[model samples]
Target: MVGKKSGKALRDEGLERTDNNMDLSSWPQVQAINQKNYYTDYLKRDDQYLAFRLQNEEARTKMTKTAKDRDRALAMAKPEGAEGEAEADGDATMEDAEDTPIETAGSKVIVIHVGSQNLRIGLSSDALPKTVPMVIARKASKNESEDHPEPKPKRVKRDDGTAEEPENLFGEEWSSQFNRMSADLKVHMRQNKRRMLPNSKEMVVNFNRRTVPETISEHNDPMRVEWTELSKPPPEYIVGQPALRLPDSSNPRYKLYWPILNGCCNETDYKSKRELFLDISLILEDAIKTQLGLTSKKNWPQYSCVFVIPDLYEKSYVNQVLEMLMREFAFARVCFIQESLAATFGAGFTSACVVDIGAQKTSICCVEEGMCVENSRVNLKMGGRDVTETFIQMMLHDHFPYTDINLWRRYDFLLAEELKKNLCTMDEASVSPQVFDFHLRVAGQDTQKHTFKAFDEVHLAPMGFFEPTIFDNSDKLLGRRKLIERSVDIYDGQSNDPVSTAQSEILTALAPPLPKANGDSQPASSEVQATPARPQQPSALGRLQDQDQTPRSSVAGSPVPETNGTPQAGGANTPAAAPTTQPSHPAVESRDDILPVFPLDNAILTSIAHAARSDEKKMKDFIGGYYGRWRGHLDQWFLDERLRSLRPAFTKDIMIGVPPRDLDPQVVVWKGASIFGKLNATNDSWIGQLEYDRLGHRLMAYKCMWAY
Candidate 1:
């Protein structure tokens, strides 16, 4: 009874004894006891307990700091002077300075933008890319040398055998005819100007015209490099500007080759795929060595590459280029962005209908949210060069001052190109006949200054894009060769060995396979028949059709199944009893089709229609705005008509974005690629060296940001 009586008294007695002992104990013993208790508790607790304690400590610290801030703000009195405002701004700046810098994997990136006319290459840090003409000159073989011997400069002599007085390079009759034609054209243009509707007139204002001081335009004389001035002969292989500068006399010794043509690989020039790739490698190697100043291949491994490809690209072209970068050049990593997407990025637009009129091709694509709508891609086989050729043809017919204009000759080609750039104008106000001077400078010959008169020819040349029939007279169109689409490995169709049926079946599970030939089809085995069918998922098109109430078929002209059956009113012999047929919509011909190429306007409309089928938002974006990148003259009449036609399809007026005055349309794609190069890298989007090593060229399919 005495022992149990005092449970509360015993606790109270123990607490009093502990307090008395603590007051009497030494400090060292007290510290040792506390440390022992902490170690015992630490050993008993799990990681979860420790984590909870750490989180609680963090919360308490944050709350204390916040309270301190609040108290300081309440204690400080607001000041009314500029000094007080400066102090407030300084505090804001200090707070902003605490933010960490964003990390990017583009420090050592090498951005490459390859085009038919030029190859742009530079580091991601470069403000402007180093441009090189996409042309190479190699030593001619023995057969080529035999076939194209050097031609001695020929002088036209009169029948009397004495050298005739230098005739007007422009024949007298030809000059007279052109002079009259120019006058007539001027009259017609004036009449057309008068007929233009007042409401349709474009109002242009030059607010800075008076403020802008007139500066004297300086003309630099072309550098005279005589053959005798050269201490050594040209190198065995010449690339870029050097190749373009080679005198016509050197044509026999060197065979000029363009690695790309009409926005694709120039496969027709080379006898084999290996040779084509070799030439491409050589050109790229030269650019990296000379322009980048990375003379040794050893440094290439340290850099990553952002290759800008065409919007309507060939899979083989992408694969080969990737392989060349990762395997041939040993790049650290590789990524690909379509030209349209890169153009949008460079131009800083979230959505646009990119109309890129390049040197040899005009590509159209609708880009949305950094992704290109594949169905909207259209590549025309004509561009700036076509305009140049057409311009030259017009000049020739109009008694051009330079009658010896042969595009095959380097000097003549350069002179014609220069003339085109200087004279061509899209503005109607600038189309009056004007006298322009050009200095014809050919290597190993004296520079000759010639004055020429240009009228409608300047504007008419660029009109070839709208009225393509004008290009029919040019040799480029007549002599154009059809190039076979190149493929690799399994796609090449050269393999004699049969493809594995098991692999085909696996692919079929993912997507419907192409119909097999009657001879290729094999009987299924009992084991194959016994296997259970995998659940089939609806395809994108199928799902879209499902959402739509209208009966539809995947292929045009294919019969649609009748969901609601009704007995025919007519007998079996009647026409109504026969199966009803849906009229087939005319298919848009492919690039390889023998039919005429689709017109630009129709192509754009078709692209928009395809976009509508897949996504309504994307269709709106496609019709929203146009970003034109044309170096040559743009046909305003055609463009305006296209816009007018599209107005009914959209509620809002379509916009055509005008590029900044300082931006060069020719290099916009390259600039976009540079922008992409600076973006933060993602493992799934970029193909690093390790991934390339494991997957080879196939890495593009898995790692490419867009659908491969």
Candidate 2:
């Protein structure tokens, strides 16, 4: 408390009585902060709230645009009875202008490479393609008649003000424009349809599949006099990046669907086959418009497209996809490319064993001189998602036991992916001391901080590829090295080493005849025995024939017996000596035997060494870290001297392994498609729109021939 003599004191100490607090309220920074607070208050919502508002706003905007579009379209579609003279005058004025085709090989090219997890799309001129989640959600609609299109007119006027010309009817431009407009109409109508829950009075099929009557009352029944249709929102197909949010339960009415999976048309989806194709086409259009920044609607018909599909895509599916694209999008030109070839070419590899690790599985294929070795291609059910799941389970059981499994599977799976990106390492060690810290968020819970160490568990995901036991029935899967071995063998036939060749011949020559049962008379031998036959056990040749063990390679310099003219030594595994008392089978004949020999070719070893020296992480990690656990199959393939010897003779350069992301395998397909488009332009190799139409679905067979 201050004393009451302040006035007198103030008079005595004049200016000192004034308040000394600095006035910072008028500063720009303070004002800016205040403005931010006001802005936040004005918006006042979380993501879901904003999304709700934005969706409604978008619906309004779409309706306005659609109404305006409809009006403009109707005006354009008006019969030319009255406007014939005006249009004739315009055509007369523009008659000097020459008509040109819209599609040209030199035009812009669009490449879309669809993977199980993402879609990589870009213009051929761009350095890199844009990636978006391969997902789509159909939107909700309020009114059924909003997009109910009228029966299309018999003929639509051209933008050039010309009446329908008979010759131009078959013209590329007219066909493309017609197809595009028709596709757009169909898409709008499809989006406008309301997806209703079975009527409230109808039955509800619960998870148990029990049909129970829905909780509905007579008051809400449509049959009631006062009942009316409730206001419903307009439906739209949520596609690409935006569709990712549908899984959060924000808009339960919108279900997500994948138009393409594992790099081909999706067989399992919530959408119809035609619907799926339309969705993918729509997504492609959106990607072109939004991501590539190609806004001019007229420029669409001028673009060519390349779709990179997986090697395993069925012929029928390929035909269907091609037909759909040609009928729906109707780009100037379109071509199909296999995913493996594209990746290999994109990586600038002349010869490589590309191990593509995708979301659904890991596909390995060998490419020699830009061609995929058909027989060597193999697929594994383990991939990035599998690794994430393993990590999630580890965290749930070993680290955070209280977290809900279902919630983690739904929401935290993304966190697991993030964790993998941050903490996962491909170090060539059985165990690593890598440690990382990250946050995990549950739907209704606070974010929890987690410190994850013991990267041994993290290695399990990649290791699972080498050791199949990490997952169920994975033991049937082949390891990376084995895949390479098999691919090399397929590329270069059986061993070419002279010694192996000779040994194989000798073994084939010495193969004993099939042994007869005791009840049957023994087969007579060509050579007669000097000693009288003793009624005793079966002869040594008969016993050996009976054993019939899988033939294996003999060690170098093993002894060969000449008694009874029997085949030299049975095999390296066979004993050096046999009892002299046993007589040789009389019917036995001298012949070379075939032996199972896994020769580790020197070229293969050299290839592996080259890969290791070049810092190929997958091969390096496989050799240093995974070899011990995966040696059984690896040894069978790599330990053979013949394979090692044949490796040098292998003319093509061999790449040991490819890491999933080393060269950005995700976008590699797009890059490959771009390369193919350029090559097609240079060599005039691409099939034209006219040719495609003439051949129809047979273009796929032609593509296959060209690809092989």
Candidate 3:
């Protein structure tokens, strides 16, 4: 009791007498203790309150859980149910569909709308993203130096049976090594024509024996790097534009570096996607800086972009693009889509059939009822650039290729795209030869005239505006491959194998009966080869087919990589090149069947197989048209009655209690649209274009609306 009293007295004295118990370094440090305590006192009070609230929350959570358990137990133990249920028993885990809980892990992942080019990066937000496209660029350059040389690949033969080394086609150490060899060859020719490499020692002695070092110095003479033009190598680009690094139009065909972007429209190897990406990224970054004035030195390309690329983008080209982005743009996420899909998505709600006629290529995506008709996607290799190429080849045929380009090149293809976009009509007979004679100035000179009838004869069989015939001649050159896949061959050899109803169902569902008629199901007993659950079993000769193997460790049907620089080849586990062996009897020629206009290339191919010989040409035309129809299909997806039902029934707002302080409760709780709709609505862009005023009459049961 006495000790306790003494301790209390000391505490009291310390609190009352401030400076007496405080630490003092010399003298000035005494204030540090006072300053620290003064600030900490208010914090200590707030911390105690926080601790009390946390304990209260814990107690509340436990009570709530206990109450829930009790209520559940009571319900299970109900007298009428429990006593009567003594007759009924079942497995504990098994449940009806209505009782099944939501499986969060298996929830469908929703795609978000963002920009067009980027890589992954950190954001301050807590939400983990559902999907991200790889936009990172890879680095590639010709490394011919001794210290950092490129690895050599084993030589391989070309399809036509010519063997070539990698260096023969790829770059080599020509600048330094070739120069030395040239000097040696000149010296040898001047002094010792008869002195072969095997006679080097004998020749040195026989040639009046200059010291080896002296000879070497003379060959490597500093004067060799002189002002004379004879020593320089001739430039490589003596003719037309170069080829693409990746097989697109962007990079010139001959440049050392070529990384093509989706929708590229220029020479490939000479320019690169990296160059274009930088221009885009800079525009975005500067726009952000101008608007927000963010001072923090953070990473760049903070958001992401979507890129649409062809299926055959080469590995090296993709890698180079990613490497450049990493080196230049700071950090971003890249999203990849089929260029057709992007155009369709962007234009889906606006047009019934989207025909994206760009500078380099034209694509068709047919949308029926506002959803992308998966079966009706089509991409034509011919674009406005093909028109320009046709014009150039026409000039070449006329012996004025170089002369004409100097007159009009830049605006040529651009004009072609504009023409297709603005002037093209579905009427074939209306397409006249005189339509091409529109005059444009060449290099600001007197107006020059040209006509489509004067089309370069070279492209007569090449530029297929709405048909696959453009590639027919080239494709014919690639004969049937020596090794057709065994699986396809065996599948074809079967006889009396009943044509399964499943295959017919898939094909016929594509063409539903007219509007008032109920859809008919293919009878289960029909005899057709069963859906083998494979796409192809062979490799494309020139079609850039993908190998039928799982990509990395991903399971079958996982989407192909969605990266800005990466190539996309449909779904995972795609077959390379399946044999197309026609069946013996009626399968070869079905007379009365009409092909479904489902707006997809694969669908067209399927339809083409059943078409009459006379109709084959017309079916091929649909392949090119499919790409343009996709937009029309996707535009209608928003009009789906299922989408409309999700919207809030009432337009009026209700008052909840006041939100927590500083909570920025402006969060919009959309009534009907899913998360995707909210995101699409972010800027009132595409979704808003669908006027809400006319939506009243189209309402239907939600499930039936979006259902397939």
Task: Note the Cα lDDT for every prediction shown.
Answer: 0.58, 0.45, 0.28
- Pick the winner on TM-score between candidates 1 and 3: 1
Q: lDDT of candidate 1 vs native? A: 0.58
> 276-370 in candidate 3: lDDT tens per residue?
44534443343334323433427344433222343222223333333433344333333223333333333323223334433333344434433
lDDT of 1 by residue, 231-288 (tens): 2564667788887776656534666788887787786566777777788889999999
Off by over 4 Å in 1: 1-105, 141-234, 473-598, 614-620, 635-638, 645-652
User: In lDDT terms, which candidate is top?
Assistant: 1
* Candidate achieving the largest TM-score: 1
**Which 10 successive residues of model 2 have the least lDDT summed?**
624-633
Clashing pairs in 1: none
RMSD of each: 21.1, 39.0, 30.9
TM-score preference between candidates 1 and 2, better one:
1
Once fitted onto the true fold, the runs of candidate 2 whose alpha carbons sit more than 4 angstroms away are 1-107, 139-235, 262-265, 295-298, 407-410, 428-435, 442-446, 472-665, 681-685, 703-708
Model 3 reaches what TM-score against the true structure? 0.29
lDDT of 2 by residue, 1-708 (tens): 966666777688774366679775786563335654554355455423333444356559989999999898577653667688767755764664446445544338888877667778887777788998777766543111122221111123388955444223223432343334324433543465623232211111111123122333443444222211112463466667665533443332455566654344565442355676677777777777888888766777677778777654444456666776676666777777777778766766665655466765555454556665553343334455555654444333223322333322324445666666655543323233334555544333344544434424444444334322222221212121221121112455642111212122222223332344765422333232211111111122122223334232222211122333333323323322222222233212112121111111211222233233334443333232211111111222222323323233221322243323455445666777787777652333344566576677654444453342
